[model samples]
Structure formats: structure tokens, C-alpha cells
Target: MAGPILTAGDLAVRLEQGTVAVLDATVNLGRPAHDGDHTSSSGRPGWEQAHIPGSHHVDLLHDLTDPAALYHFARPSPEALTAHLANLGIHDGTSVVTYDRSGGIWASRLWWLLDWIGIEAAVLDGGFAAWEAAGLPVSVLTPDSVTEIPAPALAACGQPASVDNVRAGRWVERADLERWLRDEAEATVLCALNPEAYAGEVPTRYARRGHIPGTGNLPARSLLAPDGRFRPLDDLRADLAGLLADPAPIWVYCGGGISAATLGLALTALGRDDVALYDGSLEEWSADGSLPIERGRADAGR
Candidate 1:
């Protein structure tokens, strides 16, 4: 399997060889407007204005999610994802590279989704910001049409572990999370929300405020350097010292699974493969009147 992280320079060379398909997976998760609508502004317009040459835009909100789901950004079924990937020209043999303006935050979500479906993909380390910083070229030209690619057979792709199984490699769902939280002894739940959001001081798209109970806040931005690249592994480990002490399972979640995927990628790079993403994240947890949520920080007794 290809590693989850790719450098901007490395991608440029791959593009020259016509060996990779790049997707701009940017999405803005800023606070809602005064009207209180949490609909995220799509990054498609920005990608149209400027993006990596030959890269296509993938709309997480529209194309990749289940349109029928009650929650925003719900994971689409494998059949749905196969169709979307085929339309995007992403095939079983294609090498996928995803990036976003906000570091690899949104890009990692696409990478995680691809991984869940048994497609090989990598996130551009540092994302578009770093690509520009390296004096790489950008393009305003859009492809006239999406190139159709052959999607792998569902059986060939292999069945992804049930969302109820957290012991599998990199993806988790609400039911799995609920079960783990009830009697978690070998797992640590990591919340990727910012301090303000985690503390319930800011307005969120969800029905409730704060984070999932028993999770510790590790604000998504904290994992990045000023330049948007991931922090050094040693530095990252230091910041997560409390959780790193134990060799237990680590489950990460964010507002709607995007930022949590970012943390998941970071953890994978740091050689922690026990990490899994809570797909519905707080989007599902908060809406239910029954699921418990917590405000402020308590020691995440790992």
C-alpha cells in the first residue's frame, strides 16, 4: 500500500509523468452565517480560480456524501462511492492525490474515504499552500469533461469492515463508537475540535455544543506547522504525550469527520495504525438526545 502522505514536489513529478489523478478536496467549515445555516461553502469556486494543474474538483458536500442521509457529510455506500469515483476518473489502478487549502484537513477526508473503499490514495502533505510556497505552477483551466474510468468490481474491492467494528484498519461508525465508549479500556477517544468549540463557547452546526464525552481535545490545527505541513513526528508525539504513553486503540472525531480524518492521517504517519475515524462524528452524536456530550476539558486518562 502507498503511504498516506505525499510531498508537493513529488506530486509535480508524478503529474509530469501522467501517472496520478489529483483531486482538490477543499471545504470551508467556518462558523455559520448570522442566519444560522451551517451549510459549508464549497471549495469548487476556489479550485476553479486556481488549482494544481490537471487536478479535478471533488465536492465532499454534494458528490461524495449520501444525499439521502439526514446528516451532512455522511459516508456514501460503496456502490455510491464506486459511481462517484468512476465519474471522477478514479479507478482501481489509478494513483490518487488529494489536497486542500486548509492544509490536508479536508484532503485527508477524501483519502480516508478512498481507503475505506479499498482504493489507494494519498494526501498532499502541506496541501496547496505548500505547493504554492514551493513556486509550483497553478492552473485556471478546467477539464472540458470528466474522463470516465473503470471502477473495480465490488467483490474485487473487498468488503469494508462494518461501521460497527472499530478493530478494523481506519474507519468507524456511530454504533461502534457508542459500544466502545460504554466499556472502553484499551482505546482513547480524541476530539479534533478547537478549544472554543470543544468548550461550547462557539456556535456549531450541530444541535448541541461541546464534544463527545470521554474524548480529549487536540484541536486539528495543533498538528500543523505554521507552513501547513504536519509538525515533526517528535513534536507531534510530545503534543500528544498523554495519549502516546499507552499502546491502546485511538479513535478520533471532529465536527463531521473531516478534521478527524486529518488527525487520523497524522497518526498513521507517526506509525500508529490502531487509529480509526468516527465517520458520522459529532454530526450524528450531537443530534441524538440520548448520546452524551461533554464541555470543557478533563484529563483524558489514557
Candidate 2:
């Protein structure tokens, strides 16, 4: 309820008043050195070098994901999330602000995850880049020096602490996607990868190449400006003109549910609430030999 997005200046004001807690959710994903190994580097080191003052680092790669999940960045169960949030000193009314150094995709992913539950939080517009551009102060203090705030006694009581308001259908699993394809549901499935990845025109780390069958291409990076901030609402409206006019629910997926969040944030900013994010995305989709994937482009969408 508080935000899907917050400007850097606004966040600064809130920080001045000690009204919000900031979390750096940066995770650098690089092309794998080998065919089977992942190349995700945590942002904690970067956050240690420089970060927004009083901000703590959240491990999106580990703490927030289910280790037992089949793929990377899988959504953790409510119980796991509750304990994780509690560990981070987050409870019912804590004002949370999330940001990332690598563009705003990772930050957007965290925001979407928080939104999936009952917690209300915001993603800092332009993320840490914009914060620095504004001449705001940065801190070198490590997380260990920071004192942990105790969660309220009622945190486990199913108030705001637990996933009391899990946004049903906000997260789409592989089965949900398969069901949509099988039933020919009136939904718009979107792939947020670039044109090359969508077309299987380049090397990919995923088990399979190309995209899910029938998905329209809407690269998530297209939603951001050169400054790594979201584009103007007017520009976004023009870009999404056709899709905005459609009544069907929009479902988005990326390499591993990371970049797709940019589309989710953009659509939410446009006042369209009928959006769902596929968490496993191509990471899980491509691994299965039975699932269908399409190569080449289609004139299905602008």
C-alpha cells in the first residue's frame, strides 16, 4: 500500500526522519564461466564498499529463496519468509525501502516479492545510482555494526509479520503456466528477455533456448531509461498502448523471475493490477524436455 516505487529524494526525506528501513538487494548475474555453473555474485561486498547510510543488505540469492527449490531465486514459503523478515527486524508497520546497484531489476524483484505477501514496501526509483546522483551521503559501516531491531511480540501472531495477505495468483508456477497453455486461458504471456534471447539467437545458460510458446516479447530493459530509472509514465503508456487496452490478465517471465519484475512494476505503475509474475520462469521451463519452446519472432505483439 505504501509503494511500488519511491523516488530517491522521497526516500532521503523518510530516512532523515528515521521512518524507513532500507535494504540493498543487489545480485550481479554474469554469464557462467562453465556450462553448468551459475555466476551470481552477492552484492554484500559492494554494499560494504559503499551503500546508503543505515541500510542493511538482504540476501536475495539465499535468505529470501528456498534452497530446496528446483531453480534459482525460487520464492520461499510463508514460514521461511516470516522468520527471514523477523530476522531482518521487519514486522507489521516497518517501512521498508529496497534498492540495488545493478540497475533496478533486482530491487524490483524484491519489491514484487514483498508485495506478494501482505507486507507493504517500496523500491527506490533509480536505486542506489539515483541516490548517489542526488549527492546523498553513503556509509562504509558494515552490517555487523548495526543493531538489530526486535520484532513485535505479535509478529508470529498472523498480523503483518506472517503472510496473512498472500496475494493469491500474484505468483505463477510452472503448473499454472502449463494450465493456461492447456486451457488456452485468455491471458497475455510475456517474455522479458532481449530480442536475441527470445529468438534463441545467442548463447544462453538455460537448458533450452528461445522462449515459451506463444509468449509476446517485451524486453524488461526497455522500461528503464539510460539512468537506470523507470521511463516516464507517458512513454510507458505509449509503449504499452496495445496491451493496456486488452482486458486479459498479463503474465510476465524472465530468465529467472528477475528482470520480469521491471515489467510488473511498470504495469503496476500504469494502474493495471491484473498482472502475475512467473517465479521459476525459464530456469524451470527450459529444463523440462516435454515443455514447448519457440524460436524466431512472431508478429503477435508490438
Candidate 3:
């Protein structure tokens, strides 16, 4: 298979063979507004202390990203990305797999970035909790040194999102939210908020529970392996492709806006150009109470 999802036990075989590279894509939002210090790459120091054997930390926040795109962080140029991947010893032949402490939600960022660069990769199923439950080996060793090499130049990423693309792509709101329940008019608005919040639940700190109306439910966890990583590409594609068949936009969001970005990253990886990120996310949507808000039955994910 061009892309394959691996189980914790299966991953053990790959590690022993030394053909695949394991990466930690964990991210945490200490503050609802942004992914914080202990959650991102720079915070990845923990991986050195313990992680999947032979696994390298992808440093979700600090590395493998163009922070410059952010009003707060500078985006990374194509050159930066090339060098970044090289440092991790990534090659066209590398079979990349990732997982994190958080639900595959944040780890999706890693899965997406590789695909953006024309590299193939997948996330671990279930995640770390599942891995530990399986009694897989964990390690605290750091490779002696990492040599940075640049990959082919990267294409521009993280562009502004549009409603038309979202309306015409494969995506679903996290849950039926107040904005949706308030009235159909309220539900049919631009994508930028975490509908989860309005659902009257807080599945993730990134947003209020509830979501845009008429959205499907595909929680990040749906793509996970028994060990916390995402499923293989075939499986992942099968899940999302069905949604795509309908010609609906895929608008992803999470409170302050990082997780949705992660979703956008994932869609972009799966060869979907119509995907978009609600960068403003919930932070912007909640700002205007004038915007209709409705509360509806909450689906766990989409």
C-alpha cells in the first residue's frame, strides 16, 4: 500500500527493521487561545525522557511549521521546511507515523504537513494511552546527533479560508450548536468558530462545544490506531472520501483556532484542495452575539 496504518505491535516490527521513522506530534493548549510552552516542539523535551522506541519528536509547535504565517509567530519558508525535515532524517522512502498525548486532533498536524510536502505519512491509532495499554516498549534515548537536510521546496500553505470551498467540500461541524439551534439562519454562516462550545459541552479546551449545522461528525480519534496514531491512508481516505462524494466543504475549527488548522493540514495532505481552515475559529464567532446561536443535540465528533 502507498500508505498503511500500523498498530502498536506492528510498529514494533517497523522499528526493529529501521525502515520507518516514528515522530511525536503531541500538542497541548494550556491556554485556550494558543498551543502553549509545554505542549509544542520546544516542549518536546519530554519525548527525550520517554517515547516510543526509536521515535523522534516532530516538535509540533516550534518546528516543522511556518510560524511566520501567524500574527504572533513568523511563517517558515520552503527552505526552512526542507531543512527541518532533513534534520529528522526524512527521505522520500521514509514511512512516517505520528501520535501524541492529546487526541489525534493535534497529531493530525504532523500527518498533514508530510502530505503537503509530497511525503506520505499517517497517524497512530488510539494514541499513547492505547500504546501503554498494549505494553509496547518506551524509550528515553536521543539519537547521538541529527543532521539537517532540505527537501524539495515547499508550496505555500495555511491560506485564508472561504465559505464556498467549505460549503463544497467534505467536513462536518463537531456538533449541533446553539448557533445552529437558534435558527437555520444562524447556523448557515461563515466557518471560523468552534461549534463544540455552543453544543453546551467542552470536548476540547480549544473551543466551546457545539458546531455548525448540517456538518458530519468525524472526530480526530476516528482516524487513530489502537496506539494513538492515526489510521493508514487508505482507511483515512475511505472515511473522508465518502464525505467528499457529497460536494460539501470541509471547514475545521477548534476554539482559539489551532486544531482546525490541524484539520486543514490533514485535508490538504489527503489531496483535497477544497479544504479550508476557519482561522478565526471560535474566537471570532463567539465575539458576535448578534450572530444567531442555537443549541442542538451534540454528536461526539465530525
Predicted structure with the largest TM-score when compared to the true one = 2
| True-structure lDDT of candidate 3 | 0.51
Clashing pairs in 2: none
lDDT of 2 by residue, 1-302 (tens): 35578999998888877777788999978854443446787888998888988787889999899999999999888778867876677766776888999989889998888777767788998999999999999888655776333223223343336567678878777887898888756688899998888898776778878899888999988888899888888989997898988888999998899999989988988888989999989889999999998899764642
**Model 2 lDDT-worst window of ten:** 147-156
User: Measured by TM-score, how close is model 2 to the native structure?
Assistant: 0.91
Off by over 4 Å in 3: 1-4, 31-42, 71-75, 142-244, 256-258, 261-302
RMSD of 3: 8.3
- The estimated TM-scores of all candidates read 0.86, 0.91, 0.60
Give model 2 RMSD, 1 decimal.
2.9
How well is each residue in 1-302 modelled by candidate 1, as lDDT tens digits? Answer: 25788888898888777777788999876775532358677898898878887788889988889888878888787777866776666656667888998667889899888877766779898999889989999887547844322222221343333333212456677887788777844578888878888877778888888888777887788888888898887888887776666677888888888888888888777777788888888878888989898887654533
Return the number of clashes found in candidate 3: 60
Q: Alpha carbon lDDT of residue 76, candidate 2?
A: 88
lDDT of 3 by residue, 1-302 (tens): 13434467776666666556677776544533432222323537666667776666666566754565532212244456656766566655556777777766555656655554555566665666667878987766548844222121112232321122212322333233443445442322233333444453444332234444444444444444655454566777787675545454455654544455445645555765666444444544444555443456444323
Q: Which runs in model 2 stand beyond 4 Å of their true positions? A: 32-37, 142-160, 299-302
- Top model number, lDDT: 2
lDDT at position 205, candidate 3: 37
Q: Backbone clashes per model, in order?
A: 0, 0, 60
